[model samples]
Target: MTPFVAVVFVLLVLCSSTLVAHGGDAEAGAYMLIATSSMKPKASCSGHKVAPSNEASLNSTWAPLHLVSGPCSPAYSRGTDSSSTDDDVTSIAKMLDADQHRVAYIQKRLAGGDTSNGVAGASWDGQTTDVGTYLPASNVGVGAVSHVRPISSLNKMIGTTAAPDGTSAVRQTVIIDSGSDVPWVQCQPCPLLVCHPQRDPLFDPATSTTYSAVPCSSAACARLGPYRRGCSANVQCQFGFTYTDGATATGTYSSDDLTLGPYDVVRGFLFGCAHADRGSTFSFDVSGTLALGGGAQSFVQQTATQYGRVFSYCIPPSPSSLGFITLGVPPQRAALVPTFVSTPLLSSSSMPPTFYRVLLRAIIVAGRPLPVPPTVFSASSVIASTIVISRLPPTAYQALRAAFRSAMTMYRTAPPVSILDTCYDFTGVRSITLPSIALVFDGGATVNLDAAGILLQGCLAFAPTATDRMPGFIGNVQQRTLEVVYDVPGKAIRFRSAAC
Candidate 1:
C-alpha cells in the first residue's frame, strides 16, 4: 500500500473499538455500552459508556439519544466474551476514514465553485456511522462461531448552507452507494479524429509539376520561393515542411508540410459518433436552474446568464420547461453569448471526433406574484440537470459504480470492520456463528445515522428462514431477530439481533 493507504489503514484500526458484540447476555436480556474517543485513555473505559441489563431496557433507553462528547465505552457484563470484537471495531474505523477522504476530495474539487451545471450542495462530509446486529454465543455451540448480516445500512452525509460570499458552509453529498444491485455508469475516452484545412490542389496526385508555388499563409513560407507543394526533394519544400511542419505526408506526393495531411488538431466544433455496429438509440437529458444567495432576484438573474440559458427559455410568454442547456466556459445565460463553443450532437459524426466538454451552470428565474394583480415577484432558484450525452451497454453501470466506489474508498476516513465468533443456544442443540462490526468518526463527523438505524432495525426485525415465512426458524426450535440501539451521547451505535 502507498503511504496514503497506510495512513488510512492505521486510522481505521483505531476507530474499530466502537463495534462490540454481547454473547449469552443478549438472550438473557443483557446489554453493553461501547464508547470511543480521540484522546488517549487516561484510564480504561474513560471516554464513553453503554447500559441496560437486557436487550429490552437497552432499546427503550439508549436507541434514540445523540452524542456530543464524553468518555465513550460500551457496557458489557454477561461474561468476558460479551465485549465488542476488536476486528469489528477495526473495520468500522477504516470505513470511516474512507468516508472522510471521499468528502475531502469533493470539497477540493468544488473549492473553485461548481461549473458542472449540477447542484453545488453535493459535496460530501468525511464522517460516517455503521450499525448492525449479530447472533448470540449461546445460539451456536460453545466452540462454534456466530454469524452477522452481510448488509448494513450505510449513509453519506453533508452540510448544505453557504457562507456570505456564496461559498458553501457545509459540504454536499455528491455520491452514495449501498452495495445495491443498481450500478453506476460513467463515460469513457473515445477515439478522436482531427480535421485540418484540405491540402492545396497542386499537391493532388494528378498535378504534374514536381515543383510548384503555392500561396503561403505566413511570411516565412513566402521566403521559400516556388517549390513542390508536397515534395521534400526540393530544398525549399524539404526545409519548410521538415523544419517548420511537424508532420511527414504520405502517398506519391509526400512532403514535410506542417499544414498538410492528417494531423492532431482541435476543431472549433465537437462531434459524437455512435458505434457503427450499434445504431443510434441514445438521447440526451439537460436542465438548468439558479443558485440563490442573499439577494434572491439578482442571484437568479446572474445564475441564468452563467448557465447559458438566459435566452428565450427563462423569459416570459412561453411556459417554463425543464430541459438540457449548454454549459459555457464562464457559463453565461445570454443567448448565443459567443462565450464557450457548446452544441448538442444528434449523432456521433455530427461534430468533430473529440471529447466534448461538460458544463454546469446555475440561474434564477421570476416567481409568480401572490394575489397582487400585475405585480411581479421573482424568486432565485438553483437549476440543476443531468444529460445522457451518450449511451453504453449495461456494463457501463458497473464501471461507473466501481469508479465511484474507488473514489469513495480513497476519500473515506472510517470503513466498516467485522469480527467472527461462535456460540450455542440455551438447549445446546443449536450452534451458530456471528460476525460483528462498528463505524467510528472524528469529532465533527456528520454521519447519516438515520440510515444505519433503519438497517439495524430491519435486520433485527427480519431473519432469513427456509419456510419463507415471517419470523421463521433456521432449524428446529430456533427463532432469530436483530436488536439494535444507538447512543450518540456515548459516541457509539450497537446492535445485537439474533440469527438462527
Candidate 2:
C-alpha cells in the first residue's frame, strides 16, 4: 500500500480501538472515518453528512461501486498526465453532447422509429441532426455518458461442477448503467483494432466449456425484440447495441454462469459477448456496461425472481471515495432509515421502457421556492444514472440561476468553465456558506442537495436543456452521499441521507 493509504489504515485501526474503549459504536465510527478519508483533505468545501439508518443494517448482497479514477478501483491508473480539472472539463463536454443524443434517440423511438422489423442493411432515415449514427440493423440504446462507476464480478469457470471459485474465475469490471438494457463484455476473437483497450483480459469462450450461444428460435433470443441483430448463418442469435455517442457493441447473444456479488451467484445469466466493440466515449479502464434498465433483458428484470426487482445505490461524495450498489434488500428489515422519503416512480407510454421517470414539482433555493411556474417542471424528469450533471429546462434553469446568484453575491465570481457558467474563486476563503438547494418532487418528497452535488470545479453543477420540450434529467452529481432506492414493483423510490 502507498504511504498515504497506509497512514489512513493505521488511523482507522486506532480510531476503531479508541471508540471501542470508550464504549462507543466502533463499527459506525470506523465507517465514518473511511468516508472522510476518501475525500481530499485540502478540499475547500467538504460535503454533507447524515446519520445512518436502520435500513443500512438490514440490507445485504451489495457490490462495491468504484470510480475508474479512484485508488480502490481495479482499473485505477497512476499515470496522472492530465489534471483532474482538465479531465472534468473534457468529460462535461462529451457528457452534454451525449445528453442531447439521448433525448433525440428517445424521441425517435417513441415516434415509431424502432428497428425491430428491419433487417440488416435495410434503408432507414431516422438520424439525429446534431450527433449520433443510425445503424439500420441495430437497436439504438441511449444515455451512455461519461463519469461512470464500475462493479467487480467474476465469470464461472467452464465445465466446472464445483462451486464458483472467485480466485480461479476470470474477474472483470463493468460500468453499472441503468440507461441501457443489455449487459456486454469484450470477448476473444475481438482484435485490438475492433475492441477498445480495456483493463480486464478478453473473455475467451473457447476456454469456458459452459459458454453456449443462444439459437435464433429460442425464447431468450425472441425476448430481445428490437435489440436482436438477426440470426447469423449458423443460426446463432446476434445483438447490436449502439449508444447515443455512436459507440457500438455487436456480437452473439450467449449465456454463462456469473457471480454478481459475494453471496449472489446467477446461473445461465444471458449477456452479449461482443466480438466487435468500439467507442471513444469509454476510457481504457472500462471493460463494458452492466445493464440495470427496466426491460426484460435488464439485469434487474432477469433476476427479479431472486432479487424482488428492488435495488439501492449510494454514490460517494467525492471522486476518490468508494460507494456501493445493493442488488436487493434482504428478506427482513429492522426499520427505515432516518430522513427517509418516498416518491412515486412515474412511467409513460411515450417514453422508452428502460427509463426511470419522476415528476419534479419545484426548485427551492435557500429554503425559499423559486417563482417559476409549476408547469416549467411538468415534463417527466428521468433519473439518469450515467449523466454526470443534472439539466433543467430553460425557464426553470434561468429561475434557479437568478435565485442562486442573488443569494451568492458575497463570493466573487470567476470565469466560466465549459458548460458550468457560474464559477467562484475560493483561493483565499477559509470557510464559506452556500445557499441550500432542494428538489421537491411529486407527493411532496423533498431532497436536499449536498455541497458537492451543488458545485463542480467551483461552478454550479447544473445546465439548461436546449428546449422545454425535452424532458428534465436528474444526474448522478446531485445523488452523492445519499442512498437512493428503486422499488419497481411498488412504483416508489426511497431516499435516505449519508448512506455509504
Candidate 3:
C-alpha cells in the first residue's frame, strides 16, 4: 500500500481539526469572510472531467467554450498540443504574465494617458512576457464540437499561399475574450510575414457577398474608441488594436454576416478585417478574437436587443471536457434559481469602462475571515477570461497566504512555482484535505471555490497585484465548472456552482 493509504485515518482526524465548513449570513460590516461551516469538502485535488452538454437540443442561443490548445478545440494540432499538465502550467503562467500588462495598460488609460500615436489608450504595450513558441500553421478541418461551429464563409480572392487547397469556402476559429471590445479577423491581403501565421484560411472579404466597409463618417467608426486608426484613402474606416502581449492587428472596419448557430445569424455584424497582424503570443489556431466586453462595440452590447443583454458561460474544469457559452438564459435557470448567488455589477470611474467590475467584500479561510481591511478591496475588480490566476492586493494576498499556511501545517511545503508561492507537496498521498476558502461579495453572496480552482499544479492559484492600489482580477481558474451569468441590463452578475 502507498504511504498515504496507511495514514488515511490519521489524516482524516487531522482534517477534522484543520477544516471547517459552516453556513451563515454576512455580518452587517464584515468586508469579506471565508467559507461557511456547512460547505462540503471535495474528494480530491485531481480535477474531475465534465461531460459534454447537449447544446444542439438546447437551442441556437448556445456556443461551446474550448481552450485554444485543447483536443476538442477546432485549432488543436497534435504537434502543438498543450493538453499535458506541465504545458498547462507553463501556458497559464505566460497568460498570467501577459495579464499584468493588460492591467498596466488599463491603469494608464484611466489616468488620461494617450499613446505616442495620438490615440488614447491605443497602445497595449508594456513589460510583456513571451507567451510561448508555436509550430508552423497547418490545416485543421472545421466542425462544431457542441452547439457552435467555426464561422464559415465563401472565399472570393483566396491567395495561393494562404489557401493551398483553393477551396471556395473556409472556416476560421476565434478566441472568445471578455477582457476587451471589438471583434476582428486577419483578412485575405494579410500575406505571410505581414500577419502572424494562422492554421485556418484568412477571411477573404472579396468572397463574402455580404461584406461592406464602414464609412469614416459612420457611427461605427466613432465607436471604435482608441482603436480607430483613421480613414483610408477611399474614406473607409480603419482600426488598430494591440494586445498586452504586444500583438497588433490593423485593418478596415467592416460589417459582415456572423453565424452564431444554424438557426441564429446576425447580419451586419461590425468587425475588423486586418490586413496586418504581428505578435508572438497569437495562437496559430485562432484566426481572430470575439470580444465579449461591456463596451458598446462588444458582441453582448450589439446583440442586446435580441438577447436582453444577458449571457452566461460554464468553463470546463479540464481541457478534455466541454463547456458552453450561451447568449440567453436557459430554461434550467428557473430550476437553478435556488442555487444562484448574485451581486451587483459595479462601475468605477477609475477603471476601464469596457471591463466587468464587481465588488469584493472579504476573504475567509477555514470559515474565518482573514485579517485584512475592507478598504483594501474597495476598488472594483474585473472578471477576466484571459487571466489565469486571481490577483489580490498585496496586503490581502499576504494575509491569505499566512492564514492558509497556518491552517495547512500538517502538509509538507513545496518550492514556489513562478508567481505562485504558497504550495504543498502531496506526493504519495491517497486523499487530500483542504481548508475551505470562501469569497464574500457585497450582496452577502459567497462562492466556495472548487478544489481545482484553489490549486494550480499543487500551488495556490493566486498572486499579489502590481500594487495594492490597482484593481484586482478574478481569473478563469477560479471560474471553472461554474455558470457565471452577466445580466447587463439588470446590472447584476450571478453565480451557480457545479454548472458543467
Candidate 4:
C-alpha cells in the first residue's frame, strides 16, 4: 500500500471505535417532507413502435450472467504503458486520476458549448469528415467509462439466470453514470485495438437474430438528435455520440433486448452499434456504456413508459462493491416513498439534455448558512431532478469550501485531497465533533448529512471545480449513501439517507 493510504488504514484501525460510534445526529425528523410524495412508477412498456423482428427477441431472449463478464478490470496506464494490477487501492486511485480528464470533457458538454459534431469538420482522430469511410468528430477527448468502476464485486442488481432460450447471459462490467446519454456497445466488425477496451467482450450485433437498424426517417432516429446524425447513401440511420473524455463512436442505430429486471425485458431497445471508433480502448473496457442520462435516447427514456419514467440508484462508498440502480417504482411500493427526501429537477436548453439538474436552494453548515449566491444553483424551473453531474462547479466549490472551513471545529492543517480543499487533521485524533451539513433544496426539502458521508480519510471530500465557467454539478460524493430516485417524466427527484 502507498504511504498515505497505509497511514489512513492504520488510523482507521486505531480509531475504529470512535468512528463506529461517532455521536453524530441522524436527523430522522425530515421524513414527512419527503413521504407526502404520491408519485410512483407504473408499467407501460407497450407503447413503443418496435420492429416486428425484434418483438420475439425482446420478450423471449434471456441472457443470464450478462453482467458477470464486465469485471471492474484493474487496467491502469499513464500513456503507452498499461498495467493490469490486482491491487484495489492502486487501481481505483489511478482510475480516479484518469477520471479528472473525463470530468473536464463532460463539463464542457454539459455546458452545451460544443457545436461541432465534427461532421463538416475534423473528428476525434483529427481526420476530415469521411461519410464514405467513417463518421468523424473533432476536439474529442480520449476517455471511457468501463475504466471507472472497481472490479471487486459483480452486478447483483441485474439478474443472472438461464432461460428457456438456448443462449445464456454473458456477464460484463458497466460504468454507471447519469451524465451519459443513450446505451451503446461495440458490435460486429469491432476492432480490438481501436475500440474502447474493457474486461467484457464486445457486443456482437450480428449474432442476435432480433437485431435491425433504425431507419433514418424514424422518430427514434430524430430523438437520437441531429447533432449525432451522419448520412451515407441509403444510410440506415447512422448515429454517433461523442463521449466527453474524447471517445467517439459512429455507427448504425440498432435495436435489441436488455433485461433490467428478472422478467423485465426491454425489447426493441435502441443502441448505437459502433462500426467506427477513435482514440482509446479503455472506453470499451466493458461491453459498452449503459447510459442513464436524461435525454430521450437514454435507457431510461426508451423504458420510461414501462416504469413510469422513474429510476433510482445507490452508489456505495466501498471502492470494490457495486451499488444498485433500480428502474421504475421500487417493489417496497409506498413503504419506499417515505424513506426519501428529495429536490426538484431543473432544466434549461443551455444545459445538456442528458443531465439531471437540481435546484439547490442553500447549504447549511453547522447552524449557519453559507453566503453562496443563487447564481451557483440557477434554475428557471423548479428542480424536481437534476442531471447527476460527476463533478462540482467552480463557483459552488469555492463557496462551499469557504463556508465549511469557517464552520469546522477541527480544522487541522492536513494536506489536500484530489479536488477537496477543506481538510482536517485525522491523525491521532479521536472523538472530534463534526459540523452538520444540511443541503436545502426546492419545496423546502432539506437533507441533513452525516459524518460518514463527507469525511474521506482525514480530508474534507469537496474539491475545487475543474473549470471556472463550469455550471453546478451534483457529484456522486454528495449523493453518497443516499437512495436518490429520478422521475424524469414527472420532472421530480426524491431521496433519503439509507444503507445503500
Candidate 5:
C-alpha cells in the first residue's frame, strides 16, 4: 500500500438537536462569501502529483469559513522556511521519516488480513488502506493520482470575535471533511506523551479565558458516541482516533466561546483540543480538522435546529479559483438558491450517520446507459459508503470499465498513470475534447460531468477501484466545482453548477 491509495472514514460524538421555532425562514439572512485558500496542483503533463502546499491567498479577512454570518475564523500563521533553522529542518525531516513508517504499518496490517467492523449490509466498516497505502489522489483513467481533491482546506478557521493577538483574522487553516464526524484542533501543553507538529500554532485552552471541560454528566457528553472519553475514569471528556493509514490522535473535549456570526459570540461551543497526535498522512497545512458530518458532536448535526440543518459549499476545480464551505440554512430559505437537481439521502440506522450517501439510479455516458444494476448503487444491501454508483464491486467496475472503453473507442489512446487506465493520445495535440458523463440519482438529481471533471490534460479522469474489499468512494475529482448543499433536516442533497 502507498500514500496514493488511502481514503477516509470518520466516526464520533453527537448532541440532540434543539432550536427555537422561527416564524420566518431561519436561513433568510445568510452570508454569501467568495472565500478561498492556496492549494497545490500538478504541473502539466509531468504525470506526478504535487501534494497540496499552502499557496491559495484569501483576503485573509474576506468572508471566512461556511457560516452564513460570522467573525468565526481559524488562525493561519505564516509558514516557516525549512532551511531557516535546524529545528525546522528536523521537523520536516521527521515527518518525511514518519511517512515511510506509515507505509510499513499499513502493509503489515493489510497482510494480517480482514479487520472489517462487524457491520451488516452493503456498507463495509472500518478504514480501507489500499494501493500505495495512504495516497492523496488516485489515477483517473491513466493511473495518474496527481490531483488533490477539494473540501479540505490548507488553513484552519476557528470561531473568533477579534484576533486576540490583533493579527490576521485567521488563526490556522483546517480541513473540512464531510465523511467524518469528529471535530478536533491541535492543542498545546497536551496532557499526553506526544504531539504532532502542526503548521499553525496549537490552541492553548489554558490561555482562553472562556474554555471549560465537558463533564461526564451532560447529555452532550452522551452523544459523543465513539469520541467520548474518560467519563468512567477521570470524569473529564476526552477522545482518541486512529485513521486506517496508521495516523492516531488523542485529546480532551471542551466548550469555549467563539464568534459564530459577524458579531455573534457563542458560549459552550464544543470541540476537541487534541494535545497528542501521531500520524504521517496529514496534509501538513493546519491546526486540525473541522467536522462536517451527521453525528451529534459534528458541527452540522449540533447546529441543525438553528439553521434547519442546511449547509452548502462551492469549490472550483483549479487551486487558483475560489472555493468555500457555508453552513446553516433553513429549508424555507433554500428556495432562493437555484439548483440543477436534488436527491434524497439514503436512510440508515448506523451510528455516526452516513451524511453523504444518496440514492443513485443509473449512469448515462454520451447518451448510452451502461449495463449495470441499480443494486450496485442502492440501499443498505450494497457494500458501499456514499454509493456514488461510480464506485462498484470489482466485477461491476470491470463491466463499467469495458463499456467505457467501448464508448471511447473513437479516441486514440495514451499511456497510463497510477490506476487511471484510459487516456487520449496528445502527440502534438493542443486542446482535447471530452464526452459528457452524467449520474442520475433519485429525486431527479442528475449530475453531468463536464470537461473539467472528465479530462485531466490528455487523460480520461476514470480511475480503477483500489480493491473490492474496501468501501467505494466518490472522489472529489468527480464532484469538482459543484455546489453541494446538504439539507440534513430535509433529508436531501441539492447540487448545481457554480462558479465561486
Candidate 6:
C-alpha cells in the first residue's frame, strides 16, 4: 500500500529466491584449459579447431598452450554490412601473403555439394592455423616449398562419444612450447618439493649401513633434531629451577641426594652455597622444622600488622545454604557466605560501629485538630505578612471560632429567609434548620485581632499534627489573609467567620 512497504516486500522475495538458488552446495567451479596438438585449420572457421578422425589420436592434458606467429587466413570477407565471401589457396607462393606465413583455405562441408573446386572457393583468411599443416620448414628435409591444401577427407568422419569407464575416445591435442627446443610431456603431474605423507626421507646424506642414535647436544643434531638444554650438573625441578643438596663437597648432586629432607630445605641450604660448589654439595640441613599450616592466617596477620587492629567474626551457615563472614569494626564489617544451613543474626538494638550519630527527638505543642504541624510551613511565607491559617496562634483560632458561631446565628434568623419564602412556599414548616458549614478565616483577621493574633502566633510556633493543619492549608490561609488585608473596592472580601 505504501512505497516503503512495497520496497521491503520486493527485497524479501529477491533475498528468499537468491538463498534458495544458492543453497549450501554453492561453490565456485575451477576452470582449466585442455591442451591439444592435432586439429583442423579453420574447417568450420570457429576459434577452436575440430579434430579429424585419422589425426585426432593426440590426448587431452593439462599443459600451457604455446602462442606462435602463424599464417593468417581470410575465412570471411565482408561484401556488404550483413554478408561475407571466401576463397581458398592451394599453391605455396600464393599461400604466403605479405604477412610472411602460409595461409590455408578452410571449406565448410555441405551434404550433396559439388566436389570439383570444393563448394564455392572461400579463401583462408589469416586467423587460426592448424599445427600439423604449419610445421617448421626446417623440420622438413625437402628444400622445395611445401604444397598447401585443405584436407577434405575429414568430412567423412563422424563424432565419437566417451566410454563409460572413465575413458574418452575423443581427445584434443594442442601445441605446447612450440618456439622452444625442450621437449615436454603433457599428462604428467607437476613435481611437489614439500614433504608429504606419501613421500619420506626427502634427503639422505650418509652412505653407511650402520645406524646410531644421534646425541641431541651434538653439532650434527642441528639438522632435523629435537631441541636440547646446555649440559649442567644441577637437576631441573618442576618450576624450571635447578636444585641440589648441600652436604656433598665434590660430587654433583640434587634433591634425590638428600633422601630424608623436603625439596625446600635442600633448596635453601644449597642455594646459600657458592655458584661452582652449588651442584657438588649433596647433603643439606634437614633438621629444621617446616611451617606447613596457615597460609590464609599469615595473610590476615600481615594485613593487620601493616594496617592496624581489625575485628572479624565467622558467621554460621544458613538454612538455604547462605551465611555471612564479617570483619573490621564490630557492626561495620559483613560478608555474605552461602553454606548449607544456618541463620543470620541481625540485632535491632545494636548500633553500627561508625562515626555518624542517629538521634530521635519529639516536640509537643497545643492546637486545633488538623493534619501536619505548622512548623512544616514553607520558609518563604515566614518573611511575608500573609497569615497562614494552619500556622495561626491559639487566640486567633478562638476568635475565628467565635466569629463562626455569630455568622451561623445571623444566617438562621436572617431576612434572606423571608425573601426565599416570597419566591417559594414553605409556610407549613414549623422548625428551621440549615446545612452544617466549616469556617476558614484569613490571616488579616487573625494577625490584627486579639483572638486571631493568638491563633496566628500559636500557628507560627511549632504544633503537633494532631492539633494543626497541613502545609497546603497553611498556604491557602496565607492567600485568604492577603485578600482580607488588601481588599479592592467593589470586591467583597469573603471570610469564613461564620458556620453554615
Q: Which model, 2 or 5, shows the larger lDDT? A: 2
Summarize candidate 1's per-residue lDDT along 391-416 as a digit string, tens digits.
Answer: 11123223322332332232222222
TM-score of each: 0.15, 0.77, 0.77, 0.68, 0.64, 0.11
The global Cα lDDT (0 to 1) of model 5 is 0.42
Model 1 alpha-carbon drift over 4 Å, by segment: 1-93, 109-500
Give the candidates in order of lDDT, highest first: 3, 2, 4, 5, 1, 6
Clashes of 2: 0
- Cα lDDT tens digits for candidate 4, 218-256: 888777665456555675888875544465777888876
- What is candidate 3's lDDT per residue for 401-456, written digit by digit as tens? 99888877877898876788997776555445566667888899888776546666
Question: Over the stretch 1-500, how does candidate 5's per-residue lDDT look in tens digits?
Answer: 22221111111111000001111211222111111111122122121112222332221111222110011111111222212111122332232233223222322332343323211111111121111111121100000021322223223332332333332222444445565566677766754347655434456665555567787777777766655656536677777666655566667777765443222333456777777766554434345555666667776665554445666654334422334444454233335456547877655564225346666566666566668776665432111111211344454467656766765675678665334456555444333333456767777767765344554434444443345443344434455556567777777777775323
Better of 4 and 5 by TM-score: 4
Q: What are the clash counts of all predictions, listed in order?
A: 103, 0, 14, 44, 58, 50
Candidates 4 and 6 compared: the better one by TM-score is 4
Candidate 5, TM-score vs. the true structure?
0.64
lDDT of each: 0.17, 0.56, 0.59, 0.45, 0.42, 0.16
Write down the lDDT that model 6 would get.
0.16
Candidate 2 clash pair list:
none
Model 4, residue 234: C-alpha shift (Å) = 2.9
* TM-score of decoy 4: 0.68
Query: Stretches of candidate 2 above 4 Å error?
Result: 1-60, 77-91, 107-167, 331-334
Question: Alpha-carbon error at 412 in model 4, in Å?
Answer: 4.1
lDDT of 2 by residue, 245-316 (tens): 556678999886554433344557788888986555444344566677787888888888767888877766
Residue 444 in model 5: shift from native, Å? 2.5
Candidates 1 and 3, the one with greater lDDT = 3
